[model samples]
Target: MVRLKWRYRKRLRKKYGRLIWKVKNRKGRKGFFKSTVHRYPRRNYRILVANEYIAAHLAKSLGLPVARVIQAHVRGPRGRIKRGLISMQAKGGQVIPWKKAKKKLLKKPHKYVKQAKKLARLVAFDAWILNPDRSDRNLILHKKKSGKKYKWYGIDHGISLFGNPTKWNLRRAKKKFSCKKAYKFCLHSGDKKKQRIPRGLKRFTRDNRKQLGKMVKKIQAMPKGKLKKAIRRVPKGLLTKAEKKFIQKVLLCRHKHLKKALKRVSKHFA
Candidate 1:
């Protein structure tokens, strides 16, 4: 657990939680702050903060691009919330709305063939984690320099394990988790009216399904030790022994069919 002492500026409050004022690093660099607090009965995620922390690490380990995340301390309305989590806002990138990108993207969705290949792994990653929040809105289009190609980033996993973080429990995590809802139209064709591939994954079939297969095999072959090490990144006391074990089971079960599950969906893009 890392401690970030925030130097207050202004607060951006939302329904979920508030973003801390900008923080100044040792070099006095300023950056944005996001905090996740524990909600009661209707919602609880003291453990969920840890979940996001672990998820981010796992995503990075698998070579997936994600925002920088760390566990930190921030003053909440109640008091100093130790369970708070922080993500360093990506600088100098514009969020390309799906509508605009769709024109260029779908027309030659695989134009940047390398990125298209990465998108396959990303889609498979979301499926494995069962995150349904991979909408176009979360994709960040970043251009490093003038006339350079854009770099894409997949953000937000606060709701990965369960639509509502608090909904995760021992029984649910240990059971046979289903991707039906998360992968709905993308992986399994259900309703033409309701089903569609995520904008970020529209070009998922590039490389003749190589990246998808590679990611699936990578996830399925994750050793128990590595999985545990990643999950343990959560702050102490945030997750119980039972909760950790539950999440482990969920990942293993999900990975078991991840390859075939994604292969079925890749055909749509084909």
Candidate 2:
């Protein structure tokens, strides 16, 4: 909820013809600026913007709860315009950070069973996208007005595909695809001696194995053409022809091995 500087806001308004109200200030990362008129905030780099755009479409195809993102033009350094993305903010609920949401789930497991399942799906989604930055602050938890139910959504895929925005060569993509390591959830507490299974994952026990397997199947069943269409949605110049082809190849390859990768991590639930 950090407000943009007056000077910066004036510059953006002059170039983009929109008023920016706030920008999220994530340490070590460029902030996402929220627009007042359109509610579609601008992100930092074109590469990161393209990554968010492609990731959102792919997540939706797999039935994940991610915000809709669209390509946008924003004022860059020295009054230059650059390609960016604007993610629609979720409505009708108060957004809670993952750390607070985890505490609530752990304290009241029965009340939040549904959220646990969503977390399971999110973990699987992160693995497929090769996102290693699903930290405690990345997942957003929306508590409804009634406060009885909660909706979970994943965000910030700026470094997901190829694991590096600047480097999308086949060698990097291939190395990431061949990796067999399971994606770990950032649910562990600070005390190492008291570390145990997090409540977000505890509800997904043996009975839910079939449900998890089904999610894997759904991802595998995703048509290659659908993925192509999603990638093609990214505005031209944002992603190079070589980068697009590399991403398509990497995703298809990962889909083939998704089941095994998920199974390797899901054993903990059993």
The lDDT values for all models are 0.59, 0.56
Query: Clash totals for all models, in order?
Result: 0, 0
Q: For each candidate, what TM-score against the reference?
A: 0.71, 0.67
Per-residue C-alpha lDDT of model 2 across residues 1-270, encoded as one tens digit per residue: 323322223222322223332222223222344232222333225456666778888988887888666544555446644344455456655776566765667555447644465556666677677665666655666777777767777766765664434433445444444324322221111111211233455354344566567777888889999989888878777677877887787677667777766665566553
lDDT of 1 at 268: 62
Best by TM-score: 1
Instruction: Estimate the Cα RMSD of every predicted model relative to the unseen true structure.
Output: 5.6, 9.5
Candidate 1 lowest-lDDT run of ten:
186-195
Clashing pairs in 1: none
Q: Against the true structure, whose lDDT is highest? A: 1
Estimate the TM-score for candidate 1.
0.71
With a 3 Å backbone cut-off (N, CA, C), the pairs that clash in candidate 2 are none
Off by over 4 Å in 1: 1-43, 73-83, 92-102, 109-116, 172-197, 206-208, 263-270
